[model samples]
Target: MRRSPWATLAVLAFAQFIVVLDVTIVNVALPDIQTDLHFSAENLQWVISAYTLLFGGFLLLGGRMADLLGSRRVFVIGLALFGAMSLLAGLATSPGMLIGARAVQGLGGALLSPAALSILTVTFPHGRQRNIAMGVWGGLAGLGGTLGVVAGGLLVDSLDWRWVFFVNVPIVAVITVITPVFVRHVAAARAGDRAFDAAGAALGTTGLLAVVYGVVRAEPAGWSSPEVIGFLAAGVILLAAFVRVEARAKAPLVPLGLFRSRALSTSSIALGLNGAAFLSMFFLTSLYLQQVRGDSALAAGVHFLPMGGAAIAAAVLSTPLIQRFGTQRVQLGGAALGVAGLFLLMTADAHGGYATALLPGLLLFGTGIIGVGVPAQISAVVDVQRHEAGAASGVVTAFYQVGGALGLAIVTTLSLSRTNAAVAEGASHQQSLVDGFHRGLLIAAIVAAVNIAVTLASPQLTPDAELIAEAAAVA
Candidate 1:
């Protein structure tokens, strides 16, 4: 079948939406999932962290697999695996089973996300057509995230939390059936690319996993536990070894040269900051809406509707903005919006109404993030060769996940610490929680502010550049 590029993009974007949607949908269902499955509070966090941890850990390897094997083939495999795991999660009889299923879902997401983005990179020609494709891609990614909460609330209210996972089954099945008819595979153009680097794969995956584990524990372990220190130390050492291995390998899992590209380097670092701010904003605000404002899951999700709309609008607008003012200006503009949004959130109180309080802040935060994010996404993968598109896509995606995870962990800890201090000072629990949330918002504002400086200082991007430089440091 000779499918048009737009049709191919539609398939890819839908798949990407499904993966992104899963990231947040589960948060609303955690209480239900835990109650039904009898998860300990300690283990309940894993329902969310399991997916994020595994997804971040395996993203680099997954991207490499697409490059060496075939993006289309890997895409199908990933979709099927994700669908199967979704079913398993829906049917799980215990916490361990559900958590394990979510872990596999993470693996599937890591594979398909990079594969889909890489396919888009190869399919669309650079400039206007590519810009449109990337815009749609970025828009839907944000849309998926914003809508996940709403959809989760609806599902949990009307049906059951289990339906959240089961809903993916039909969507996956339809996409899987139509994929090969539209998405074509491109062969790697490099010599000796067929050889696999087993050693590199092990080191990279394990190292990333170790670091994510350490960060995840730092919130609970107070960042000073011997186990957390040990894991962080091991992850760093292993990553260092992975770099040496990449430098020496006949076929590096991640080419050392991709990091040489200035556009990718700047876009990637800024994306990490954007990811930290964007993701943590959602987490903290959701807690505020639920705990402080006393809104139900459904109500909290409904409140985000305006933010979702603004985010999509910003994403669509970014393409023109980027084409007009260039990447740096659009990114800075977006970062400014983020800082303003977070700063506004600092004024949010337990008694503050949604219309005058959280709504305006969310609108700005959501709009600003997509404004920053869409351009950074386009910049990250642009100018890379067809052979390395998957790797490039993977690098950008991994940074978002890793950055979001670390940011969430650090800010959650800050919030918790503040909440504890306020309680010791005899404040009401609700007020203490809000105070903690404000502190986290302040830190997030600072992060957004830093992104402006980073954007200002980045090296000029060459139109001919390839791979990612800063990403090599991340890996």
Candidate 2:
């Protein structure tokens, strides 16, 4: 049976959407999860961090698996694992069980996400088709984050918080069943191919997990604390070791040569910085709306509709902009807009209304993210060889996850410290929270400025004729 390209794109895009949605869907339901499971405030954070840590850590190994085992096979297996874990998470009666399930869910996402992207990269030609697909993919990616908050609120308010996990069951089932029909199966690795580097996988995964764990804990334990310092140092050493292993291994988990492509390397860095700005914006805004503005979860979610609309519009607009201006220029322009947006957000006060203070910033920030994000994604994979597509996708995604985690940790710690100081000096609770948020936004603005500078300094990336021809042949 033959499948339409659009159908294939839809299936893959939906898979990516659900995987990304899980990242933020649980946020709005956290309070409910904590109360139902009797989780302490400190431990509650683990509910989010556990999933993020494993998802970020195991991505490389997962991408390698997609290359060795067929993308279709690995994708199906990931879906099965993710669905099973989601069921387990929904049924959990204890905090331990839920966290464990979430971690496994993260691993499932690690396997599924890059495999989906790899399939898209190979299935779509590298010119207009791929660009449009990427625009759709990027649009859904942004929409998923916004939608998760809305969906979480709706599910929690209308039914139960557990429904957030349960929601994945039907979606996964539908996709799993239809995927084989739509996505063609690729040939798996030959039996005599190079051996898998077990050492590299172990070191890389552990190193990432350690680093993410330290960052996540930094909010509660100060950055100077022994626990934070020890974990961060160990993670760095392990990562250095992984690099050495990769350099010498017969079949490395990641090929160091992939970095030779300036486009991929620079785009990866740009994506990381963009991730930092985007994630912090979401985190701080959600807190500001609920804690300072006293909006209900449902109300806060609804309020984000404007941001989501803006992102979708920008996603649609990005393809033409890239065609006209090139990826480098569009990306830099987007980062500049993000800086402006963050600076505008810095002016928000405790007494400000959404229309007056939040709407303009959210609009610009949402538009800015889609501008940067879609182009960077295209740039990461457009010049890579077919065989290396999964690894490149994984690297880009890993940077995104790691960058967001690190940025959120830094900004959260700084904001909370400032908030505490303001409280000590007799500021109202609302005012103190706003003050901290301002400081965090200012830091985020500086990060965006850095992104703009980096983009300007990097060499412009044009589409390679050979790469486009190769991708066209594959498609």
TM-score of each: 0.85, 0.87
- Extract clashing residue pairs from model 2: none
Candidate 1 RMSD computed on C-alpha atoms after optimal superposition onto the true structure: 4.4
Please give the CA lDDT of all the candidate structures: 0.78, 0.79
- How much is 277 displaced in model 2, in angstroms? 1.5
Poorest lDDT segment (10 consecutive residues) of candidate 1: 465-474
Off by over 4 Å in 2: 1-10, 34-46, 92-97, 118-142, 177-185, 382-390, 462-475
Cα lDDT tens digits for candidate 1, 163-182: 99999999999999999888
Note the residue pairs that clash in candidate 1.
258-467, 258-468, 259-468, 259-469
Q: Over the stretch 1-475, how does candidate 2's per-residue lDDT look in tens digits?
A: 7778789889988888988888878877776787899985445556776787678767877777887888889999998899999999999999999999998999899888777877877788767788678657766766787799899879888899899999999999999999999998866788787377778878987887677667756767878999999999999999999999999998776788999988778878888888778777777777787778877777777887888888888877776677677779988888888888898888888787789798899899988887787777777777788677656767777777767766666666667778778999999988998988898898888878888877876566555544433332222
